[model samples]
Target: MGVGDVSKRILLGRKLRSAQLGETLLPKRIALPVFASDALSSVAYAPDEVFIMLSLAGASYYVWSWKIAIAVAIVMAAVIASYRQTVHAYPSGGGDYEVAQVNLGKTAGTTVASALLVDYILTVAVSISSAAQYAASAVGWLQGHEALFASAMVLLLTASNLRGIRESGSFFAWPTYAFMFAILGMCLFGFFQLVAGTLPDVESADLVISPAPEYEGAVTTLGLLFLLARAFSSGCAALTGVEAISNGVPAFKRPKSRNAATTLLLLGMIAITMMVSIIVLAKKMGLRYVDPREFDRMTYFDGAPLPEDYDQHAVIAQIARAVFLDFSPGFYFVVTVTGIILVLAANTAFNGFPVLGSILAKDGYAPRALGSRGDRLAYSNGILFLAGMAIVLIIAFDAEVTKLIQLYIVGVFISFNLSQLGMIKHWTRELTTERDPDRRGKIYRSRVINAVGLSFTSVVLVVVLITKFLAGAWITILAMLFFFAVMRAIKGHYDKVQLELAADEDDKVLPTRVHAVVLVSKIHKPTLRALAFAKASRPNVLEGIYVATDPVETNRLIDAWDERNLGVPLKVLHSPYRELVRPILQYVAEIRKSNPRGVVAVYIPEYVVGRWWEQLLHNQTALRLKGRLLFSPGVMVTSVPYQLRSSEIAREREEREDFRVRPGDLRRGQVDERRDPGRRG
Candidate 1:
């Protein structure tokens, strides 16, 4: 049909009927990876973070690494348990926002939403940056171009997601499972080697780490606690994506809550296992890692710095190298899966953010377009927005995981704490209403679980704030605030518009008189058609108005009108400055003022062409005039479309096409089979 329609058809491909949306429902196999990649991919950088923080007191602080991991694990468990209850109780897919709104209040719900939105965006930025780091380590050419590589990865992920959730899930599923296997496989093998007393230490084992300038000296008791707290906070990155499953419960097949709960349990187990294994292996292999800035402390024999260009592999990379030294394939497998999983990890945010955005949109907090689905049954706008934000962050941070990681986990923990508190309130209210003994007991138990979760997450949130805020977490807090203000502003705008445009008691009262004005650019077929249409309305007053921009054209139109004897009077609006819209608008305003109780109807003759470029050439002034008239009170604007011969070709081509997929239709899985629903045979 039109160029816009053709481009859209090409971009989205053949559209499936909305009824076929059921086919896009994910099975467990695909759902696990689609939802779990974010938390699972955390293992790639979580250990590095823990080690970096511990490097403050050198390798001696390493022993506390495992303890910090345990603290993070406990918090992770609490959050998972809490969200499992959320999935069961609020399976409508509102996740924390709905829970907080219903149990807490609108303000608390909006706060959680703000936090989660920031977190989801950070998830994409951090994951892509981490993947870029891994890629740099794997390929020398990607080292200095980390930002570029990271941006490309984001684009690739966006394209994959644009294909719809089901298709993208299937595409990313293997890498997630492969990552699970690779990490687990490496850990198991490393453990056996340790048991056999044959485990070779990592290449960095013999290297020494120099403490930061601030932490130099004997570690005081207070200093050690602070260091451990910071390390624990860093390790809490592992828990960043735990709430995503709760946010995405509706994505699962039938029995959505049960499947979502099971997925949460599975995610927790796998994430905990992989995280602990990596930490344990790093310790056993004597992995000595430091912040990239202080990395000079690591040296080879002869007290010389390692190659200036030497790729300092990640903790998992080093451990994989040592454990699979004799097994090259296994090492490559681990590296490949780790990199892929890191990139795919953003899918967790992609899946969660759109669903959350949809909920917000439906609740009048976001643009209404995001509330609908795209042809592929995906939230395309939400996905693109997330990708765009991530790319901006990636470029700004130069795709450095360490810097981006500092901005991670803060928003999620805030959401986690708020969600748990909401759940506690929810259960308390349920207990009051329930009269059945068995159900009441179950609710009471759930309350206890939620209480424990709230306590744990509250502590973690505080620790994260205290430890990481100065280390760059304040950026994330600022981001949350920014998102909160934006969402509120959008809601306010929508509300204000709704109130202003809403029909009132006076709307039913008929106007005292109707005055019709036909806008004529040329006395041609289009103008004739518009004049005929305007005359049919039988207004109390009818006149043809034209801006006298050109005297020659004005004279020609007057002569033509007189020759045709159209009977309608012609009014000339003089504009020496050649301001078309302003003059016409002023004329309409004067007319309306002359008869306050009369309605002025402006009929604009619009050229309807097949090509988009043709539209640009024609109707430029008419469009702007119509837009201005819409905002004017007592002024009704109508477009009298005059379709040209070219429009027929476009209409025929559209009729021949089988279907079309529009934006937002993919999310809801709706497909338009007909070219135009209003078109008749």
Candidate 2:
């Protein structure tokens, strides 16, 4: 095997056969982590956001924490119930984009696709950036390099996911389950202590939170409502990954829709529990956290302003410390798992984005490359593209979770509202045709569920826009619009190309005559071989064409051709500007213009070398000439390859690679065969 094959094997494991795709289908246990980690991991930071926004109004506003949590939980439940209908109705994995496209027309479908694309990207950026922050908190040296760290983590996740979904799911399942167990365990233990009146206070309990200057005095009812709306908008980050399951229903094992719906229900319940528990615990423990950028708003117990350097631990971290104050391991364990899960959360995006991209590609709204899977049955191109986009975002925002989180849930909520609305329309239409009373009743129930979901999500999306538009949510809106425009443009371009390429009744008609031109640079072995090959083809008119870059060389080549008594005439095209490719392309076009019914064949000699750098030294002119000539009508471009000595090594390596044993071959009891069908004499 060549070095690239070896490296790829090490990085992505052995390629799976198409028949083995069934093995990559994920069961519920593994699918939860693969698809729900993002929603689950939000507990580590979403509550922190809630606390941050509430702190803008001082500790007096802390009473609203549980209220916001409950509101978010209710919306999440509605969204989940709505999507449960989506999975059963449209289980082909297009999710919201499919429903919207099929029921609401192409424009709405494209809008949903663009929103989901942007949201998936933000999911990766937010999740990785949050993980970097947690890492910086755990290790002091990691403070200023979070962007680099986050970018590297994205690359790692991309590689892991390229190994296929089930493998990655299994690999990630343990950490996700561990996180769930640790957080739920801590919450249960903390609640038990609370019931017994023995819960401990957090480290920040003594620190007093003062409202920002705007909220210091008595505020109007509208101002108070806006403040609560802002807090709730921030808390809605918890719902960011709920639609991932709906988008990924096809990835589930047997009874795909049922399994996916069950997973969605489990994901919503767990996310709601964790989020609410964290918020309640934060309020109970008097956890004080505000945007560090708003340092003047926080104060010590003695009325002194907090120092600019005060590093506020996350809300979950504070609760973990306070709840397990006596046991150092418990605190460390919780913090460690929280950070790991935050990083793993991006895996959900890695899984969702590629599938959605593939669907878009299949629908002709994206580049066709995204529709092809890698050797491992994973959408490798889409995975790598998502990682690259996430890296750009991480670097652009400097991996600050708070800043990245501001642009977080807007796209998600947009998708949610549109999807729910689409589902409502879908069921309404179905109910009209579903005559069985029992089935009609189910459809009616589904329509009502989706209608409620739409109502709630529409309100939240408005609140998110109002609360976050000026605070960076506009960037996400702009990005979604940009993607929408680009996809539409791509679709337009593809449609034009398809129309231009359509075959007609005369497409199979033969050309009247064939004229072959062998491109010649000098009187060398490659040129002679090209001349000989052209002669063997026996075209009606065969000629050796040369561009006269230098008069002396051109004359010498003519003299050499005469001396060899070559039967084919040599035609030299003079170039005053010393150009090679343009003159050849222009010459071919002239030939076609002279005899429009004839086909012109341009054979260019190209040297094939083994090493990559060697390639740069050769084929420069031949490749350019071929590229230009291929665009001319009635012309065909061909490359006659001349293999160099180093190319032998490459050939041997490829030969060996062809016989390499793939995964499952041994298990299937297949014999290793090194026999080559094209063995050279």
How does residue 472 of candidate 1 score in lDDT? 96
Q: How close is every model to the real structure, measured as TM-score?
A: 0.95, 0.95
Backbone clashes for every candidate come to 16, 0
Q: Which digits, one per residue and each the tens of the lDDT, describe model 1 over residues 353-382?
A: 999999999988889988888877888899
Q: State the displacement of the C-alpha of residue 681, model 1, in Å, after optimal TM-score superposition.
A: 15
Judging by lDDT against the true structure, name the best candidate: 2
lDDT by residue (tens digit), candidate 2, 1-681 = 657788998999987778888989998989999999999999988898888888888888899999999999999999899989999999999998999899889998999999999999999999999999999988999989999999999988988999999888999999999999999999999999899999999988888877888888887899889999999999999998888998898899989999999999999989999889988988888788889687776678899877767888888888999999899899989999999999999999988999999999998999999989999999999999999999999999999988998899998888888888888888888877878999988888889999999999999999999999999999999999999999999999999999999999988998999999998888788888888888888889999898998989989999999999888898999999998888888888888999999999888888989988899999988877777766788898878889999899999888776676666666764434435444523
Which residue segments of model 1 deviate by more than 4 Å? Answer: 1-11, 300-302, 659-681
Model 2 global lDDT (CA atoms, 0 to 1): 0.90
